[model samples]
Target: MTPTLGFFAWIIIGGLAGWIASKIKGTDAQQGLLANIIVGIIGGFLGGWILSLIGFDVAGGGLIFSLVTCVIGAVILLTILQAIRSKK
Candidate 1:
């Protein structure tokens, strides 16, 4: 099993990743700090799972890799959400 990141690590990394993802997706203006953090945390989980499924080792990849993973996941998540919302 991959070792889990600590609480503060999650917050910091998640916030950064989420903020970046939102900016990339053009949704930054619609989200606040708390929302970014939450997106980041969830995006980390989603990213990790997707990477694992693709046979990538997500553990011990260090901070930069983790952030990249989270950003990719968050972008994907935001894309999906945007699509769904647009369809409504």
Candidate 2:
């Protein structure tokens, strides 16, 4: 996908993934929609990179794979964020 298209796609995936992560982490009440989207998108990129590092390809397989990977990343990110916040 082109950069612009990929960005938009990530935003959508991130938003949904972030929402899911928030629910799973029990932090939904503390985050807004935009924050969730941003976190999810960044988390998706991070997750994809980590997966790639482990020799797991995240490309292709349509939106399902995208969403799954993004969600996984968002959950990780959210968990870390919660931990950091707790420390503060």
Candidate 3:
């Protein structure tokens, strides 16, 4: 089934995913709402791409799966970001 999402849907997904990412990466207080949204959106793209590459299709739900996938990706991204930042 094809999923139909609206602007608010995206916001919800981004917020939840980003929050989860921040909590996982121990950066919840450091990153604000806007930053979370941005990271979450980017993480969504990254997650979807990675899933597709592995032959996994994730485009059915409204913001459930999307949020979960994005959170996972965001966590990974944040981890990488932290690692990189630590080196500098």
TM-score of every candidate relative to the true structure:
0.94, 0.86, 0.87
Query: For model 3, how does the per-residue alpha-carbon lDDT over 6-61 read when each residue is reduced to its tens digit?
Result: 77877778788888899988999999999898888778878877776787767764
Error of 3 at 36 (Å): 0.9
List the candidate 2 regions with Cα displacement exceeding 4 Å. Answer: 1-5
Residue 34's C-alpha lDDT in candidate 1? 93
Give a tens-digit lDDT track for model 1, residues 1-88. 1437888999999899999999999999999999898898888889988998998889978888899988988898999899999999
Report the Cα lDDT for residue 6, model 1. 87
Q: Which sections of candidate 1 miss by over 4 Å?
A: 1-3
Pick the winner on lDDT between candidates 1 and 3. Answer: 1
Name the best candidate (by lDDT). Answer: 1
RMSD of each: 1.3, 2.3, 2.5
Screening candidate 2 with a backbone cut-off below 3 angstroms (N, C-alpha, C), the clashing residue pairs are none
Clashes of 3: 0
Alpha carbon deviation, residue 62, candidate 1 (Å): 0.9
Question: Any residue pairs clashing in model 3, and if so which?
Answer: none
Candidate 2 structure quality by residue, lDDT tens digits, 35-77: 9998888778777877778877677546877777778888899
Error of 3 at 59 (Å): 2.2
Estimate every model's Cα lDDT from 0 to 1.
Answer: 0.89, 0.79, 0.79
52: Cα error in model 3, Å:
0.9
